[model samples]
Target chain A: MEIPNVADKWTSGVNEVTIGATKDKGGSRQKTITVGGSKCIPFMDFEGNPGHKPVIAMDVYDIPPDDWTETLTRPFADVINDPAQWAKKCVEQYGADLICLKLDGIHPDKGNKSAEDAVKTVKSILAAVGVPLIIWGCEHDEKDNEVMPKVSQAARGENCLLGIVSQDNYKTLTATCLADGHSIITMAPVDINIGKQINILVSEMDFPLNRIVMFQSTGALGYGLEYSYSIQERERLAALTGDKMMSMPVICDVGHEAWRSKEAKSNDNDVPQWGPREERGPMWETITATSLLQSGVDIIRMNHPRSVAAVKKCIDRLY
Target chain B: MISIGERINGMFKDVREAIKNKDPKAVQELAIKQTEAGASFLDVNVGTATADPAGAMKWLIEVIQDTVKTPIAIDSQKFDIIKAGLSVIKNEVLINSSKGDPEELDKYMPLAKEYNASLICLTMDKCGIPQDVERRMEIAMKIVEKAVEHEYELSKVYIDPVLFPINVDQKQPALMFDIFNQIKMISDPPPHRNVGLSNFSQGTKEKRLLARIFLTMGISYGLDAAVMDVLDKDLMDAAITAEIIMNQHVYSDSYLTACRK
Candidate 1:
C-alpha cells in the first residue's frame, strides 16, 4: 500500500482549525465545530481517535415537496404544506443535528420564485430553525449563484455550509462564502476525478481547506448506488494513503439521492408483489444513508425523519 | 543530496531520556539507524532542553560522528550550544537555522561563512509568520537578503519556508502549497529550499503517511531539502520519488540507489 514516495513533496492543513466557535471561544453558539485537522485519512482510529464522528443533517426545504414519496410525505401531513412549520418540526421533533434548508422552491423557472423571494425564504428558515443550517441551491447552476449569495448573506454569522459551489458558478459562490466567512460544500457529479478536481480548484482559490467539505454526490440503493460508493471509497483510500488535496472529510448529500430513487417512490398498486410500501420506502433511503456512512463520509445530508433515525442507528454501530 | 536525519531532538520523550542518561549507546544506535536509512546528514537538536543543551549537543555530535561518517546539523536556538556542538563534530556542518533573531543570524551567518558551513534560514523574522504568499516571499527574500547583505555566499544559505498543516481548516493546505511555490519563484539560483516535515504532520492521525505524501507532492514544485525522519520507509520512498521527479536521480534508477543504499 506504500506508493513510491516523491523526494520533493509538500504537505498542508496542519493544526486543525475549529469552524463553529462557541460562546467560550467567542461566538454566539453553544458549541463550536471542529473539522479538518487530520494527520491521516478518515477514521484511522489507530492513528488516534478521529476526534469526532461524522454528523447528520436533516433536510428541511425552504418550500414543501410536491413530488416527494408518499411515506415521507405522510409524516409531515399538513406541516408539509408550510415551509416554516416543516423546518420547526424537523428541529423540535426529529432531533436533527443540523437543518439543511433547500430553497428548491426558488428555481427561478421551475418554481418560478424571485431572487428576492428566495432570500426571504432563507431568512425565515434561519429565524425558524434553532440549530446551525446548511443552505442549498436548486440544481439550476446559474440561478443558484444568483440566489445563493442572497441566502448565504441572510444566514451570515450562522456559519452555514453553502451547497454548493459547482464547476460553473464556483467563482461567484466561492467568493460569497469567502467574503462572508462561511464553510462550503464542493460537489462532483458522481465522479471521483471530478470531486478531486473541484477540491483542488476550490483550494487554489484560497477558500480554506478546513472549511471545504468534499461532496462525492450521493445515489440511492439500486439506482447506480455502487458508482457513488466506489467513488467515495476510492477517494477515501487516496486521501488516507496521502493525497493531501483530496484528504478533507467527505460529505454525502443522501437526501437528494435517497428520495429520487424508484425504491422510495413507487406505490403498491405500481408493484403489488413488493409488499407494504410504507416501510419499504423509508428503508430504501435508510439503507442508502447507512451504506454511505460506512464508506467514510464524515457528514450526511439526509431527509425523512424515519430515514434519519435509521441512518443514525447505522452510524452509531459503524463508528 | 544531504538528507539530514531529523530525529534525535528533545521533542520525542525517548530521545530526551536518552540525553538525560547521557546514553551515548542510544545516540550511537540512532546514528547508525539514520545512516543505514539513507540520511546523508544527521540533524541533532536539543529542542527546549535547558539542562546542558550544549553538553548534550556535544555528546550527540561526538557519538553520531564517531558511529557514522554522515555530516550533522548542529541544531539549536541557543548560540553557545550550537558552537559547542560545532566544536566536536568532524564532518561538514549545516547550521540548523539562523533567522528570526537578527542578533543570532548576525553572529551565526558569518561563522557559517567563515567555516565553509551551510546555513538554514527561517522565512520568518521578528514580525512573525506572514499569512500571505507575498509576505512569506518578502520574508524569504529578506532571509536571502541578509545572506547577501551580510556578505555570505548565496549558496551557503538555505531557505526553510516554515510549513504549517491545514488541520483546522481544510483550505489552508493549498495556500501553503502556493506559498512554497512562490518561494521557489523568488530566485533562479535559489537558496536551497527545505521544510520541517513534522510541522505538516503535527496533530494528524496519519503522521508518517501524510509526511511522506506531502513530501512527494512537494517534489512537483521543487523542494530541494528537508529536515525529516530518515527512519520511516514511507518517507524514504517519498524522497526517492521526489529525487526522480526533480532529476536528482535520473531515469528512476536513482530511487533504487538512494533508497537501497
Candidate 2:
C-alpha cells in the first residue's frame, strides 16, 4: 500500500520580522534575530517553507523582583540587583537568544523610579549584553508614556523590540519606537479581534507593519492555557490564510503566566500532593512554553533557566 | 472581496467621451481613482462607444496601465475585443467572461491557461440568462466541470451566477442567492463566486440602496468577487463590513481605510 499525501498549501505566510541591528545596519548588537516567516502551521514542514526557528528571550528586571517565588529567583539571585549583570547572565549562562528587560520598578505603585533611572538601566543592559534586547514597559499607561520614550532614546539606534502598547495607549510608544528605529509589540486581552485591531491602530500611525510583533495575553498550563493555545492557533491560521492585519509574529509571556499558577508558585508544604516546588515550577513553565510553541509562537518570553533549557531542547529536537 | 471596478467601461459617459476623443487623461484618472478606492481589478469595456472596439480596448488598457498597476479584466461579449485588450495587458489579467456553453468554455479556457489569466465563467448560454435556480446551478456545475477538465486552478476560475435587474424579476435575485450557496458544493475548494453587482440595480429608482443591500446579502451567501462601482463608498463599505462580520476580514476601527491600503 502507498501512503497518501495530505499536505495543505497556503497562499500567504506570516511576516518575517527581524529584531536588533548590527553595526552595518546602524545598531551596536553582535547579531540580529529574525522570526515568523512560516508558510505552514507549526511543524508540518512538508507542507511549505518552515521559515525561521523560534527563539527564547529570557526576562530580566530593572529592580530586584519583590514577588517572584524562590523557585523562580534562585538561579538569578547573584545578579538580581544589577539589571545589566542580570541581562548578561541570562544571555551568557542560560543561552538566551535575547534579553527582555522589564521596567517594573518605574511603576508609581512599585517604586516610582524616574525616567532617568529607566534610561540608565537601558543603556547599561545594551552595554553588557551582545544579544538583542526586548524593552518591556511597566504596564502603567501614564508612566510608560513618560519613561519609555526616554528609554527608547537611550537605546536609539540599537533596534531593540520595545513594547506592550495596548489599543488604548499605543501612540506614545509607537512614535518613540518609530523615531528610535525599533520594532514594537502590540497587545490585546487574548481576543483575536482586539489583537488584530491593535496592529491596525499601530499601523495607522505610519509605523511599518513588518516592524511589529503581536502579544495576545497568555494563560499558563492548567489555567486558561487552552484559551491562549486556541487563540494563537487561530492567529496562525489567519496569517496563513492571508489576513494582513493579523500576520505579525506572535510572542507569548510563558514564564510570567506559568509561574503565577499555584502549581508553580505555591509552597510544596501547602500542596504536598503536587510534588516539589523547584521541579514543579520549571516543568509548568516548560510545558506552557512548549504547548504554545505547537500553535506557532515566534518568540517566547521565559523566566526560569531550567525551563528555558528544557524548551530549547524540545525546539532543537523538533526542528 | 475581489472588487472589479466597473467604471472604465465605455458605456459610462466619461469613458465614452475619453474613448471618442482619444484623450488618455479622463480614462487614466478613472483608473487611478478606482485603484485607490480598493479595486482588485479594473474591468475595461468599449461598450458601443467606438466602431473599432478592439482598437479602443487596446488604447484603454494602455492608458489605464500608464497610471496604475491594478489588474485589468477585459470585459466584452465579443471575443476579438477581449483578445485585443488581453494582448496589451502588462500586468495581471482577468477575462471578464465566457458563456457557460461548452463551445465558449472550450475557446476561453485554453486562452485563460495560456495567458495565466483568471476567467469569469458566466452562468448563461445561447438561450440567455437562466431565470430559475435549477437552470443556473446546472450551468454553474457545467462550468465547474469544464474548468476541472481543462485542469485549471479552481481558485483562478470565477463562476458568475448572472444577476438581472430587480424590477425585471424580483424572484430572480432570491434564486441567484440560492445558486450562490449551492455553487460552493460543486467541488472541493469550489470556483471563486462572482456577480455583476450593478445588474441587480439597473433601471431602479433606489439603485444605490438596492445594490448595497443585495451585495451585503450576496456576501453572506458566499459571493467573493463582484464587478461593481468601486467609487460608491457606501456600497464598498457595506461589502467590507459584511466581510468582517463573516470573519473573512479582521476588523479594526480604521478597517475601511486599511481595506483600501
Candidate 3:
C-alpha cells in the first residue's frame, strides 16, 4: 500500500494584521507590512504556507536609556539621545522591517516628559523613517492613559501601531487608536483567557479586530519563558481552530524581558560562570526569540543588531 | 467543533406544533436559543410535521432567517424540500445530505455547487448502510471520488460514517472511529468528518451519558463536526474539556467562556 499524506486539518488561520497604511490606503507611510495568516503551524511549509514572513521590529526609546548594556548601546552611540535619528539608523543601517518606538520617557519617574514631548517624538520619527512604526507606551497605566491619546493624534492617518493596552486599562488607547485610524496592541500577562477577554473588550469598542495584534507579555529564558512559549503555542492553535478572539497575530517583547535577566548582563566578574558579558546579552535575546518563533510568533520586538540578524536568518530559512 | 444544532427538527414536539399551526414564534425561539448557545449552524428539518414538506421547509427557513443570521443545515431526504429550503436561505447553507448512490449525488451535486453550499455525504449507497469499517471506507471513497468528478472542493464535503445505535450494536462506535481516522487520511485536506451524535444513544436508558462519553471519544479520534443538541450544558462542557486536552484550545481559566466568544 502507498503511504498516505497526513495533512493537518485547520479550519481557520491566524488573522492577517497589516500595520501602517500607504498613500492609497489612507496613510503617509511609504510602505505597509502584514503578518499572520498562517494556515498551519509556524514554518510548517510542508503542511501549508505560513503566509507572511515573521518580521523584526528594532526597538527605539523616546529618551536616552541609562540602564542599557554598553554592547547594546555601541551600535547606536551617535543616535542614542535622539529618537528620530535612532529610528532612522535602525531602518536605513540595520534593515529593520518596522521601528518600535517605545514611549519610556513619559513614565512619571523616568524623563517625566509631557504629552507634547511624546507628540514631538512621534512627528520626528514620522519625518525620519518611511517604514511602518509600532508606537508602544510605557508600562505605567495612568501615564499611558494621559499621553497616548496625544501620541495617537500626532500620528493620525499615518496608520501607525499604537499600543500595549492591558486588560485593566485598554479603553483610552483602544479608543484613541480607533478614532485616529491606527492599529493597537492588546496584552495579557501570560494568561490566555485574559488575552482573549482583552480582545473582546477592544473589539466591543468598535475597533476593527483585523487591525489588532496580541502581545501575550514576554518572559526571558530563565524567567518563566516556558509559560510564554506554551501560551503562544496555544494561541496559535486556537487561531488555527477558528477561535476568532485568539486569532490575531501575536507580538512578543523580547528586548526588554531578555535584557532584564541577570544571566544576560552578568559577566565573569559579576557572576563567574555566565560567560563573557558582551556576547551573553545578545545571546540571551537570540535564544529567547528563536524559542518563541517555533510557537508561531508573528512579530518580535528586539534590541542588539547582532541578535536581530541571528533571528532574521532563522526566519529566512524556516519561511 | 462545528456544532449543527439539532433542536429545530420536527421530531421535537414544540417544532411539530409550530409547523402544524404555522406559528413562527416556536421556530424563531429555537433559532435564537441555539445561536446564543454557540451552535455553529442550525439544522432545520420538517420531519413528518406537514404533508407538504417543501412548503413547511420554506416557511421554517424564513422564520429562522428573520430571527438570526446563523447559517443553516437544510435536513431532508427529499430533494424538493431541500431545494425549497435552499431557495429561501439568506446566509450560508449546508445540504444535509447526499448518499453514495450515483443518481442521488447527480441530482444534488449541481445544486450544492450552484448554491456554494456545504454537503454532508453519508457512507452508504444503493446497497444501504455499511456494517463494517471496510465497507464504510469504500462508500466514503466513492462519495469523495464523485465529489471530485463534479468539481466540488473537497473542503466543502462533510463525510458521515452513519453512526449506529450503540444500544443495539456495542462494537459500532469503535468501528466508526477507526473508519474516521483512516478517512481523514484519504486526501490532502480531507473532507470534514461529522456524525449524528445522538444516534449512538437511541433507544438507550442513559442516553445523555452514552452520548456525552462517546462524543468526546469521537472528537479525540478526529471528528471535526457534529449534528448535536448544543443546549446540553454538560455535554458541551465535556466537548470543551476534550478540546482543551486535545490542544485545540489555549488553556485559560475561563476557556468555557472564551470558546463561546
Off by over 4 Å in 1: A1-47, B1-261
lDDT top scorer: 2
Better of 1 and 3 by lDDT: 3
lDDT of 3 by residue, A1-319 (tens): 9987777867789988899888888778999999988999887777776779989999999998888877788999999999999999999988899999999999999988999999999899989999999999898999999999999999889888888998899999988899999998999998888898888888878888899999989998999989999999988888887888889999999988998888887656877677787888899999999999999899999998989989999989877
Displacement of residue A9 (Cα, Å) in model 2 is: 3.1
Ranking by lDDT: 2, 3, 1
* lDDT by residue for model 1 (B166-224), tens: 58555545565776677666654467778888778789898888888788877667676
Per TM-score, what order, best first? 2, 3, 1
Determine the C-alpha RMSD for candidate 1 after optimal superposition of all C-alphas: 18.7
Reference-based lDDT, residue B104, model 2:
98
Any runs in candidate 3 off by more than 4 Å, and if so which? A1-4, A23-26, A261-281, B6-37, B49-52, B55-69, B79-92, B97-248, B251-257
Positional deviation of residue B124's Cα in model 2 after best superposition, in angstroms? 1.8
Candidates 1 and 3 compared by TM-score, better number: 3
Please list the Cα RMSD from the true structure of every candidate, rounded to 1 decimal place: 18.7, 1.6, 5.1
Residue A49 CA error for candidate 3 (Å)? 2.8
Docking class for candidate 1: incorrect
